[model samples]
Target: MASSFSDMGDNLDSLICSVCLQIYKEPVALPCGHSFCRVCIEKCWESREEDCVCPNCREVFPQKPKLKKNVAFAYVVENIVNVKKGGAGGTGGTESHCDVCNGEAAKRCVPCEILCCEQHLKPHQQKEHKLVDPGVKMEELRCTQHGKPIQLYCKDDGRLMCLMCMGGQHQDHKVVAVEIAHGELKDVLAAKYPHVSQSMESVASQLQQVQEEEEQTENSSRDAEDRLEEKRRLVCQFVNESVDLMKSEIKKRKMEKLSLLGKQREKLEKHMESLREGKSTMDKAFQELEAVSFLQDSKDLLKRLETMSHFKSMKMTPLPVLDFSKEEKNLDRLITLNKNFLEKIQKGPEEHPEKVDLDQNNLRRLYGRSPSLDPNSAHRHIKISQDLRTATRTCTKSQYPEHPDRFLYDPQVVSCESFSSGCHYWEVDVRSSSCWDIGICLNSMRRIGVESGLGENPESWCLEKHYNKYSAYHNKQKTDLSVPGDPERFGFLLDCEAGELTCFGDSRVLHVFRGNFMDPVKPAIAVYYDDDSVHFVHLVK
Candidate 1:
């Protein structure tokens, strides 16, 4: 029996101290009513890594606790140790004083809300009774206002409620039992888990796609920058090469001027030396000291003078004067070249000569012609410039005679030169207005009626603009052609042998029309309405 009791004591020792798990050694109590060994709890509280807390229940303290020894529990420990050593017997956990009689509590009288010894409990049980957990804080379990336990969870208000509140402020509110509300809320969370995960996955996928597009955009932008840089490098290289060529040409011209001038200088210097020698000999003969010497010198001097008289007259083919004005003019052409180069750049590489086998230089050199308007063929409403390069419309009337070839109804005019079976090209500057007409036509189209216009007649072929749109018209029929540049400049090339008429813009061929050549077609322009104007201009190569 004694051995069994010793084993029971060993097992009971675990209930002594929560910190060291040994018999209570100077046990101290916190305000939370949890006890631990003084030194162990103080050391734990001194730790800076964590908030001060009861070792067993983990109730955090706002400040470090001023530990006070549990005097009653210390006495209980003495009795417990005495009983364990076979000194005296005592009850363990139910150690409490009866509120009714001040004796040891044997049970709790829940009806009276008090603990009682067996002597007092027997009489208190006759009213009503229930046991409660000692670990529960009764003040927290009951409401401070009504002194009742919370029973319902208000769904609408989202708060815990006592039964009294359900009748008062929470009347008719959607509510459920606390346990049921907790269970349903947990179920709702469970139901939404997959949806939340799916939403996360969708967001992640969109982010990935955005990242990919961003990367592609960055790469493409970098490639564009690199290509532009390469083009810039090529431009700089061309500038350097052009400067070298210019220097070479200047040096060559300089050397040529030097050689021609050097020959002229040599001839002048030789002539001057001969004249100086003759003068020196003549002076010596004039100042002679003796007759014999004078006579001999005079004969030589006379022969020299006779030879000087017989010398050829000082003259040769006149050479050109050394000057750089023409070269300066050529250098000034650099500005025009740069302007044309910029125009080409604005048109882009699609129009560059490398795109097609057609040689732009050859076309310009072989077929280019200066164009002028013929006044006799112009309409009465039209005004022609003295230079015959420009034509414009007017609302006022004119007293000019209606010639045989004059356009009576339409403001149209013909050019001086015409082509029947050869190549011809010219460019028109149409920058003054948004609308104009330019084309080629047979010498005889019309002299009256609305059909007399350049594009309205069967003998005429033309390209025209109305606002921003451009189209080709022939025989009163029109076809829309793609516009590759602004309407400021339009170039035309006619290959009569091949029976093709081509339109050009921004240095690129735009359209080609083939037809049989039977008549000499003159370059023409029509500005019959809308205060329109047309110009035939020159481009300095």
Candidate 2:
């Protein structure tokens, strides 16, 4: 009866799943003839993208196969488990069963695809068959083509092969014993992994530090720019306030000096009038009175004459006047020193003295413009002065006949003169205007559309100011400018041959516009707000 139970237990072991090492629950067979629990096989192939392979045999399928439950196998497994639970003496087992008899397997013959007991292992030992502990796949231990035990490892193919395969298809391939190949590969990986892991950690730490430093640098740059802007605002305010204070002081001193001079002049005039009256009395007595009266009048006259003589005898020196020669010298020296320092700062590090001289010559010479505004070209809201040197923005329209060249949409005015060739230079006094555009435009630019505004169309390039901010504009594109000082006088240099138009503020380059000039260009100005005006400054040569 014990022997009968052992045989049944050995048969039951054959039904156990290799993946879970337990009796199959809801067994599903793959196309490779390998069976596993349905849930277990699905989980094993969950991460695969293209094809799934059978875990037991490593056979790849081109596509996912549909799972089919083995109902008969599931029923058999369930019944066997129930019977084993009901029985008093269970079937005991320590290892796999022998292929020949109902006995516990002691050794496995890989090439023969068999598990043997000590009783059945004698034949394999005598024949020198390779024996190993059980629980290995029979297919993996032998070559598939030759059906012989794997004895060699082919280095070129990175696969295991039998002696027959080595002598046939793998005859010229580099080969070694399977044991040697496995030991060497294991040693190589073990030696290299530590260094590679250390390098990766070091690189990761460096990258994190670099990212932190980059953020810090950007923050510092932003802070510096903010500080610079604040300083610029404060400096400009200081200068304007100082100038106003100085003007007030000069007026107060002049009033005090004039008051002293007026008082001294009134006293001198009163003394002269008294002396003239005394002289007239003496003359009337001498000419019209008798001898006695004349003698009495002479005595009084003599007293008066004595008083006049005393006044005449008093030493009279020039009155002390206010003098500013010493103050004026000191002021001139201060101005010269500050001007030199400002020039140096504006030039920056890249510009040299020679470059400054050349730039100055370019700006001052080359047919400088003192061109007057053309009344015919002025906008209705723009008031051109009689001299035509200034154009002003007005709230009311001017009473003038409409002309074809007039600017209808904007408060703009153009010069009477135009230049088609040669270098030209001009200056615009923009001190009175808070928002204005000073530039040159082609003579053919549109005069009736919104785009007719200076710097709004392709035919114009302008240095524009909105309140305190400045920008260079061309064809509706704006480039912001950083002008250091309050520049009331703006200089423009146009080199027709070089195709460049340069704007200057405080003798420093503000912006440059480049273009190919093929048409005559006239000076143009745009003013916004009532009372705003721009004057064409006449620069000397």
Best by lDDT: 2
Alpha carbon lDDT at 480, candidate 2: 93
TM-score of 1: 0.33
> How accurate locally is residue 230 in candidate 1, as Cα lDDT from 0 to 100?
100
Q: What's the lDDT for residue 3 in model 2?
A: 22
- Candidate 2 lDDT, tens digit per residue, 228-328? 89987986786677667766877888888677778767777877887889878866876865887677667777888888877776554465566767656
What lDDT does each candidate get?
Answer: 0.73, 0.79
lDDT of 2 at 271: 77
Tell me the tens digit of each residue's lDDT in model 1 across 123-223: 76676565443222356556567888767789998988788887777798998987789678766655665565465555555554666677889999999
CA error at residue 17 for candidate 2, angstroms: 99
User: Candidate 1: what lDDT?
Assistant: 0.73
Top TM-score prediction, candidate number: 2
Ten-residue region with minimum lDDT total, candidate 1: 1-10
